[model samples]
Target: MNLSLCMIVKNEAATLHKCLSSVANVVDEMVILDTGSSDRTPEIAKSYGAKVHHFRWNNNFSTARNEALKYVKGNWVLVLDADETLTPEIVPQIYSVIQREEYLLINLLRQEVGAEQSPYSLVSRLFRRHPEIQFSRPYHALIDDSVATILAKEPKWQIGYLQGVAILHKGYQKSAIAQGNKYAKAQAAMEQFLAAHPYDAYVCSKLGALYVTTGKINEGIELLKRGVRTSEENYEILYELHYHLGIAYSRLQNPKQASLHYQAAIKLPIYPILKLGAYNNIGNLLKEAGDLKTARKAYEAALKIDDNFAAGHYNLGMTLKAMGLFTDAIACYQKAIKLNPRYAEAYQNLGVVQLKVGNHQASLIAFKNAIALHQEQNPEEAQRLRQGLQEMGLL
Candidate 1:
């Protein structure tokens, strides 16, 4: 059972070596399609024994990926990117996976690495070489339709999930986006895709997300709403549309509409992290609306899903403090601190709650700890803490 590694890259010279080196010893063959790189990327890949081929950029990921498929010599294909590296610990198990006859495709968990907030997403990148199994969707190219087509033709075809196999992706970070013209290119590609696929709910949702990220709140809200109405059958897109719509409305200061969309997102069978975000944001909006009881319930709902979620604990603490429940608020804050020792905001809030309960010494200590943590990283916040301490006659 031979596994061929396929990748399409352009101007990824900086991190290409790390990516290629990570999987060079594992795969049977490496086939890289370079989309006009003006760097040493091709040479670096070739140095690692990759059969590098030059391809013209067409603003379509599926196009390049399909072209690369023609060069794969192995029976099984593992599609990856120049910014991603497979986990070294699971490299040995990949060979056995390629030999499995029951499944037509295998799904791996791709985890974002070196980002402030890393999230894991299931992606179908490993599969048997078949002419019918190709990539689709312009901006965020996917093989869902192709996979469905293959499975329809072969009734016994199955998709298996590899639990331990994972890839670390660094290309999706803000710093990486700013390093190249990638964001601009992606925005343009999304707009182009939307023009051709006007009624495509998935494209609309993706474009709407890009608009939100680029700060076009009104436009994002309109597109997201369209996506929601057009994508009733697509639960994935509907979840995203409602979640992003809630965020856009929150930005517009329309808490009522925001809460409605957030609640809608929460009801969807989406990822737990996304559901947690919806619950937390809904709690924030309700708290701002002076609905302390409901806000507390929302926070509790978030915590029930993950008790170690420090943000949920901190948010509940804030709501409790606003309701004049100082002791309970302090307890929540302490739990947040226990979950995350470096939570400066949690410590600051704890100090405030402690001061309210007439524990000046403990309050001063908490404030000092908070100040020490934020002094260099957040000078403004540290100064504000100092002023708070002076007012309390503790400094």
Candidate 2:
């Protein structure tokens, strides 16, 4: 049941400690392969008793990950990123699974937080140590290689997906500028790699996401649509492409097309975020179309999946307000504010509902609160609040 935790990192001092600490007691050995870090990442890994190995940056993730795999001597190896951590519930599951010899690879669900969705999905992170299990694909490296061909001959070899544990990915917290730099480097590498392998669907899909993040909406949409057309049966790439396409179409104010892509995204089995986000977006689009009853149903469906989602409550309130259901709208806004007190839009909408119901005094108070919250982040919204107050002669 011995286990080894392996990772490759660079300039990750800020999150390395948190990542390593989360699994320090769960594994028998920790191996960290650092790629020319200028920060104290190596020192921090050493402090956590991790066997640190230094490797020069080769602009290839597969090479680095394969090198890290060479240092793993345990029966089971768990690959993790410095920005990711094993949840407390997953540790017991890993130990239980490793005790049995039936599985060669165990894929756990990865939960990417701070995004607009459920965040949880499946990925292969844990594997039985075998000489044949090598990594391939330069940028977003994967373990499926010629090893799969060899393993297919072994009648006892089996790969199973585990639902007991999930890896929390926190890599998206970097500032926009910092993220832009990382994406730039990744884009360069991916472009060079694609020159030699132009039909790589995964790299094409990843490049599309990078373009979207960098504000190249048209290029992103084109690349994503191309990837979708080429990789029709590839659910992961199709789901991501459709999701990004939906976002791009929404930005272009083509809600009908956006709704179509969103519906396509939700049909994929692997898209948790797409599932919830599609419902929310469809709700908003329906509200904009003046379909209050359908919009309310969509919001309710989103709330049923995630009760604490403030956006769902806020949108539900807006839909109720559009139907002239003032009291119900106020209740929805109150719930939204309870979930997220700093939600200025909820306060503003609440004020609008109050004014419609002829509660000028309460409307003034809500507008004031909205203005106070909006002052620092959004001056235009603050001005709107002030205008509302002025129209009521309360300013």
Q: Highest TM-score, which number? A: 2
Query: Per-prediction TM-score, please?
Result: 0.77, 0.82
Q: Mind giving the per-residue lDDT tens digits that candidate 1 earns over 1-395?
A: 88899999988889989988888888899999999999999999999999999899988998999999999999999999988999987776677777778888887877654332213456779888887889887667877778978888898889886755378788777778788666687888888878878877888887887787789988988888888889967665787788788888888889989899988888877555436667888999999999999999999998887686688899999999999999999999999999778889999999989988999889988999899888966989999889877886789
Off by over 4 Å in 1: 17-26, 43-49, 87-100, 111-120, 160-165, 270-274, 292-395
RMSD of model 2, in Å? 3.6
Clashing pairs in 1: none
lDDT of 2 by residue, 1-395 (tens): 78999999999998899999999999899999999999999999999999999999898998999999999989999999988899998777788888888888887877665555434556678999988888877776778554466577886877777654468887654563376477777788877877787666667787877787778889888888878878757686677778778878877889999889978887787635436667788888888888889989988988887676788899999998888899999999999999878889999899889988989889888888899999976999799779867886888
Q: Output the worst ten-in-a-row residue range by lDDT, candidate 1.
A: 112-121
Candidate 2 stretches with Cα past 4 Å from truth are 116-121, 144-158, 174-180, 271-274, 308-310, 325-395
